[model samples]
Target chain A: MYGTNPFRELEALRREVDRLFEGVASPSKLRSAFLPGRSARSYPLINIQESGDDLTVEALAPGVDPASLEVAIEGGSLVIAGEKPRPAQNVSPEAWHRSERAAGRFLRKIKLSVPVDEENVTADYRNGVLTVKLQKADAAKPRRIAVNVA
Target chain B: MAENTVQKTNGSTAVVATETEATREPERFVTPPVDIYETAEGLTVVADLPGADPSAVDVNVEDSVLTLKAVVPEADESEAAYVEFRLASYFRQFTLGEKIDQERINAEYKNGVLTLLLPFAEKAKPRRITVKAA
Candidate 1:
């Protein structure tokens, strides 16, 4: 009864609908374009952002064993591989109530558009998210240009 | 005797989030995935809440309803040249029945996963009676 105003209600409803598709309309990641259904998409989805001097890669990989995680750069592609063990391995199957969380091994290789300095890479995992920072190779970095008038 | 059975409150809604509502407007939520299992002593629930600090995660149970919510620090993505998933708060809820022992519930958080233990009450556990013959 409180939200009875027709105009206000319509405004709220429109906002909700717009939100549902808000982030979805952004450009799809380059690697997912040819991917099939939702399930076919790679596990532990990642985001790559570029600043002036570094490229940051963030991977959503929860409950992954640190000892099992492997990150490496091969040529111009970045390889991220790891295992996500089942949260409860000792629990008997008969006692299960629900198992909606996905658990398994996953590996993703992303081709970098720009060369990266292989020696200055660092990666860390915290709060179930993995952040990897790589420095751009000197030659690939944006260079300041000067125009001289005689 | 309450048997402590668990059920999802809604398709994905069991939120008791005054704290979350108090935050800035237009905040989005992603439904975290979960796993539930039972044992002779009680039931255990595990949920995935990535990018949210352990201190920011909140778990509450009241009136036979269990709610889970986690807040992640906001990151500046406006300058991001490329984007994938956005960091958002995690939200989900479950309805607990008499089959669980509410008084003895315990919780644990690690690696962005929350595990809740809902023990069975004394009355709910099966008991065996002894028979004597003359």
Candidate 2:
């Protein structure tokens, strides 16, 4: 009698149908719910902004060690790599009611539209967010034009 | 009749204003992901709230309801070249049971993650009784 029960099979089928509908309703929510211990898309979500002479990129990453994070400018692209550690306290898997946070090594590469002064790039980590500020090349900065009165 | 109607409308408006002022609704918020685990000691909750300042984070328990809130600084969206995740404050809540020790709960925030240690109440903790030989 160590086998699947008929009632359990029916319950599984019902859940599958519910999940299908949920996916259609809110794809983002469903995607995250489906992947319990792993990221549905990318490891860290990012936002990139361009100011007068600097390109700033902020990466949202929680539970990641600052020392483990690595940022580098390769060719015309910026690369970010880091590892997120799992909870240190050991607990049996069965004791976990929910485990939604994903942990592992991740690498992301973003291509820059304009050239940057790689030598002057600076990075800082605070409150689980990594901010990278890249100084734009001298020629890449927007120049103001002056017109003489006619 | 017109005076009575005006008074009733004013009363309703006052009530609405008080309610809104008490709640102080936030413009935007995101539900942070969490992990709940049970241990021999008690229950542990780990929440991920990126870009939240540790000093601005708040955790409160009232009438068996646990509330978590964190304020995130606003970023300049006009100069954003690329965006993926939504930028918003973090807000979430959970209902606690009588078995939890509300007074002894502890919380820590580091690397954008908040960890809460909810120990079990004295009465709810497991105990063993000795049996004397008959």
Candidate 3:
């Protein structure tokens, strides 16, 4: 009972093979093999910027329907979820020469570093990118204290 | 991610000029993914270039080489707190084939995605041959 199990060793070998292929295999292929239904590792990449009193988050989401996009703030996390429809219509899958783009539902959650005014948040979609503006809370704004000379 | 190799600058003077231009370039750029499909009519190319202004995007085809360039507005770097995505411009190029009708090509950009329709030349399109009874 204390000896090594062959089944366990095979499982470990399979994981090792997966790790080895991860570096060389294309993302689309890896997704199909390992992550069947999960979202792409870092899809719809986002950039967060802060100004004097406002924070902006730009999300790159091309080929997504603006009407299907949903953005919400849950506690300290900003959640973005959307779906990208397939491009081909009336054509068989075998007709595609280069099927590089992936289409499916994706969800990404980002943590905000500063407290924001939930009521003042605004979101705009343009040129396939979604920019969300969140006004910093009063307490989160930087304050200046004057030194007194005695 | 697709590999969009950096353009090489030759000559000492050209290198010096590129050095100055590099300072104005964005820190980095992500290669936008593209999908190329063939249909009965011709070929269709779809590229994703998010955060790029439609007006600033340039698509040019010269000598069978198609180039796509887009400029993303630079944000205030001093205020970047949390950044998962890098802000940078996008550039990509592809070699076209002889079957493509370069003069009759059509393109459209919307919602950050660029679609190029390269119709096949009249001679390249498949035509049904009428079988005559001999």
Could you arrange the candidates by TM-score from highest to lowest? 1, 2, 3
Between which residue pairs do clashes occur in model 2? Answer: none
Query: lDDT of candidate 2 vs native?
Result: 0.75
Which candidate would rank higher by DockQ, 1 or 3?
1
| Candidate 1 CAPRI category | acceptable
For each candidate, how many residue pairs have backbone atoms clashing (under 3 Å)? Answer: 8, 0, 2
lDDT tens digits by residue: candidate 1, B1-134 = 11224333322222111223344346566567677877667778888888889889999887877888888767788657666666777777677667678889898887767889888788766678888887
Candidate 3 regions off by >4 Å?
A1-40, B1-30
The true-versus-predicted C-alpha distance at residue B44 of model 3, in Å, is: 0.4
lDDT of 1 at B120: 77
Question: Which candidate do you rate higher for lDDT, 2 or 3?
Answer: 2
- Give the alpha carbon lDDT tens digit for every residue of A54-146 in model 3: 899988778788889999998988889998877777665655545567778889888898888888889999988899999888999877889
lDDT of candidate 3 at residue A51, scale 0 to 100? 81
Interface RMSD of 2: 10.7
DockQ of each: 0.35, 0.30, 0.31
Interface RMSD of each: 5.4, 10.7, 7.8
Looking at model 3, the pairs that clash are A127-B112, A128-B111
Q: Give the Å shift of residue B63 in candidate 1.
A: 1.2
